[model samples]
Target: MASSGQFAIVTGASTGIGLELARCCADEGFDLLIAADEPEIERAAASLRADGAKVEAVQADLSTSEGVEKLYAAAKGRPVDALLANAGRGLGHAFLDQDLADIRRLINTNVMGTVELIHKVGNQMRSRNAGRILITGSIAGFTPGSFQAVYNASKSFLNSFSFALREELKDTKITVTCLMPGATETDFFRRADMMDTKVGTEKKDDAGDVARQGFQAMMDGESDVVTGMKNKLQTTIANVMPAETLAKQHRKMAEPGTAKD
Candidate 1:
């Protein structure tokens, strides 16, 4: 368990994996500053408070620089001991079918906002020579996403960036951990408009289970962890499979109207 005074920040804490991650932190005795774009963040914070940790919830759209700054300001200058950059957006459809605004929002939230926050918090952690960072990447990054093109690409960027950052910080007390989960049981599918796809309909790991794996890996200072054994195998195969084959496989699962009976 962390010391009671330890401070942690978790983004996307309104629901799903992010909320679960925040719960894990609170259970481990860390004061929390959790943020999301929705009002539900307040309710999530209330639930976390039951864990006997101080909790602050900020409702801010993390897709914009202003929103990211608002969340940082809400931290009240506390030196964050643990940072979970879990906020993200997903889109599902053929590239050409996606609205320009939606595409930009997805990229801004999943890539730009995530990187900016990491840069801000990471610099502080580096200067202090102490801190832990967990980035929520995804196994989808390992393969081509035929329907969910932009979302997967953003996750790929995160996957690569997390590794590079971890290596750069190897000599310091600051640890950068990436948590790659696959098809977790969350609102993600519905929000991404993927509920009609085979992958969306398939069984998924529980959000709590995925969060537990990620949280434990972060606490142990691991560089990366892919949650679930099935996902582990998928990632391994994705690495060896030809790009064209991988893309085709992704199409079968993510192509529109492939929902199972």
Candidate 2:
């Protein structure tokens, strides 16, 4: 069990990688406060409780400042020992063809809200001189997402932001680790409306494995991690490849109807 009185906050904990990360924290014996935009968050809390960890679930849209405050308010002034800022939304299609509201929501949830929560909790941790943060970025951030333009751009922001934050806190006890996972077995593809794309239809990494890799990296204070071997290779190649080439490759995988080819 983890040391008594440790508390962790995991966003997007109702499902997918977020849920798995919460479970890992619980297994380590940390009391948890998890949040998601959907009602399923309560169910996720119930399941975590069965594992003997103290769990609190909050259902709030993390896309707005009001919702972020609601989730933070649930912390009740406890010092967060670990934070997994994993809440994110995806949008897939030609950028211009996507709904304006969706694009704003995607930016708000993926960039604004995530950064705001980090700023809030991160300051508290800094004052206390201790904390660990694991942010879920994406391998997609390395390339230009032709169909998933906004989502990829948001992740690129996170990927860059995490590194800069880590450097800023280098002398402090706070550690910020970015977890970049490639296509994963999650509802992200379906929710993003990309199930008709080749990338969406391709084989994906297991959520459990990705979560474990991220959890372990954060614990070890690693700067960043790419979950799967294939993903790591892709990241390596992306760094050396021309930007236009990467964009073309992404278009082939993400363009609608490519899955049917």
Candidate 2 TM-score, C-alpha based = 0.98
The total of clashing pairs for model 2 equals: 0
Tens-place lDDT digits, model 2, residues 28-113:
88999999999999999999998788999999999999999999999999999999999999999999999999999999999999
User: What CA root-mean-square deviation does each model show from the true structure?
Assistant: 1.2, 1.1
lDDT, candidate 2, at 16: 95
The C-alpha local distance difference test score for the whole of candidate 2 amounts to 0.95
Question: Runs in model 2 with CA error above 4 Å?
Answer: 1-3
Backbone clash pairs for candidate 2 read none
Q: What is the alpha-carbon lDDT for the whole of candidate 1? A: 0.94
Worst 10 residues of 1 by lDDT: 47-56
Which residue runs of candidate 1 sit more than 4 Å off their true CA positions? 1-3
* Clashes within 3 Å, all models in order: 0, 0
Residue 37 Cα positional deviation in candidate 2, in Å, after optimal superposition = 0.5
